[model samples]
Target: MKKKQLSIIENLIWNSAGSFTYLICQWLLTWIIVVHSKDLGNAGNLALAISITNIFFNLACFNIRPYLVSDLKQCYRSEQYSAFRLFTCLASLILCLIYTCMFGYTMDQIICVMLYMVFKLGEAWVDLLHGFEQRKMRMDIGGISLFIRGILSVLSFMAGVRFSGSVNTGIIFMTVCTWSFIFLYDMPQARKFEKIAPVFTKETIKKMLIEFLPLTIGGVLSSLGPSLPRQFLEAEQGSKVLGIYSTVATPAVFVQVAATYVFNPVLTEFASLYQRGEKRRFLKLLFKISFFLLAVSGASLVGGAVLGQWGLTFLYGKRIGAHADLFLPVIIFTCLNAMSWFLWSILIIFRELKALLVINVIGVIMCILIMFPLISKYGMQGVNDTLILYTCVLLVLMAVLVGRDIKCKFDR
Candidate 1:
């Protein structure tokens, strides 16, 4: 029996529902910690753990999902990608542990960071499965898996924190529940479409590492670009303030998450269009997505301006709401960052890995040079200012790259 394939609209709907549910659950977890817990430092600790683990997560996944989906030529088998992913995930875990140990974090913070990394490690594994599902154009399956796992993880975390009153316990519950979903649900669903066993090959692994080295480095630097500012904020201002910033900035992140929901389902289409030399259709699709993202970003800015303080106060309490002045800059930062990533998808589709690396390297350098001074001077506002500046620089460079690539395609 042949399975009926979903239309693009169907795929988009599923992907958006799943991704939005998962992201909102994450946001809500932070909100739960803030509203229920007596100590604000718990939120701060979790925020710090997330900021640190995000970079490591990029390292573990090595930006491979996009590459996996865009491999229209099927240069490598799913097993090969799986093998490499396992290797990277293991290596990234070890590095994460070493980093947490070496950093001056206290024992509790170290435990918190390591626990969060465990959860992320599970996510990275499931992500590989999702990549396989996406390549089969069965994103609906992956979306369902994400929805289930997201719900289980959030509920478990909520229960754990409510009972134990510790963020670490909450993360432990989230990790266990999430991994259970992966083994019992995600892997089984993935196996229905393709083989889940990883086939190890020395030559293929080496080839992928070399080919993807630029992207791996670029991914780390891209994560670092935002993380450096948070690190500076925490250093200068303290965890409570960092927690407040994280809470305040949470709503702004919806803009970026929304952008991903729009573009991710169409990534395969982008590759197919470009590969088939349907340049006109490709450009039309690209412009349409970009315009939609801009429209959403504009709407978000307006909404933030109108009800930003009240919403923050309602969700996170008056302490966090007091910093509502940072709302606009945070929204602008997220919007610019989201647009930068939209351009990033184009570069990934074009396989402009070297250019991506160069752009990220310059962005990270700019971030380092300005982050400390800005955070030290303006405090939380300085952190937002630095991010805004960093993402602006990134957006401009990426636009130039995408433009040059498009012009060359048209000229030819």
Candidate 2:
């Protein structure tokens, strides 16, 4: 039987469902850990641990997913990409182990961190599969896979945390769920598109890494910029404060993910339009997408301001709900972040990795300059302020980069 390719709307729906489920699972898992754990400190430590691990994971993956999907010229086979991903994942796990030890965490904290890293590793692998599916315009398969993983992992996590009251146990259960979904569903689906065979070559790997190094650096800095506030909070205010911030920030993830779900289906079209010299159409589409994102973000900010406290209280209990004031700034940051992310997608089409790296570096510098002082003055509210400032800087920098690239292209 011939497989049906997804239309743009169908693709968006599937991707949105998948992203929505992932966000829900993320929020639920944090809620479980924070609400049910014996020690409240565990919530903050777990959040910090995940933040650190994600940075290393980006290093390991070397920003390869976008590179893979944008390989419209078919320079490398799916198996080759898989091989590269495997190499990087192993490296990332080793780094996670080393980094975890340096943190001087307690035994249980170490165990939870390691288990979480393993879980993230599984997700990264599945992401590579998603890249293949996306390149084939079969993002529905990737979306379905994410939805399944999210549901199963959340269920297993809830049961584990409830039974043992241990974040480590929950993480282990979630890891198993992730790996199970990957091997059983994700791999087979990817295989249906292209045969699986390990292809490892030093030359190809080295060349790919060199070519994409700027993007990898940009990705690393991107993660670092957002995380600086959490790091500062953990050090200056301790884990409890950081945990509170993490909980409050969870809603923002939905905005970022929703933007991706809406805009990503058309990413490949951006490249195609530009390459074919359909400059008018490309610019028109870009403007429309940007405006749509701004409008959605505006709506979210207003809605969050009005209902955030009640909604968070309803979902995560009163403890988390108390920080209702943090919701507005966080939502504002989310809107800016969503717009910045959309701009990054446009820049990706132009292969503006170096410009992105410079922009990300500027954002990080802004974060460093403001995060400590704001946190020192305003406490948890200060961290949100830092992030908002960082997001604004990124939005402006990315916009400038996009404009410069477009000007250069048309002038040539």
Number of the predicted model whose TM-score against the real structure is largest: 1
Q: C-alpha displacement of 33 in model 2, angstroms? A: 2.3
Candidate 1 lDDT over residue span 83-162, tens digit each? 89899999988998898787688899999999999999998998888887777778898788778888888899998998
Each prediction's RMSD to truth: 1.1, 1.6
The per-model lDDT (C-alpha) reads 0.89, 0.82
Output the TM-score of candidate 2. Answer: 0.95
Q: How would you encode candidate 2's per-residue C-alpha lDDT over 172-248 as one tens digit per residue?
A: 88888789878998898888887556699999889877877888889888888887788877878888888888888
Positional deviation of residue 11's Cα in model 2 after best superposition, in angstroms = 1.0
Q: How big is the RMSD of model 2?
A: 1.6
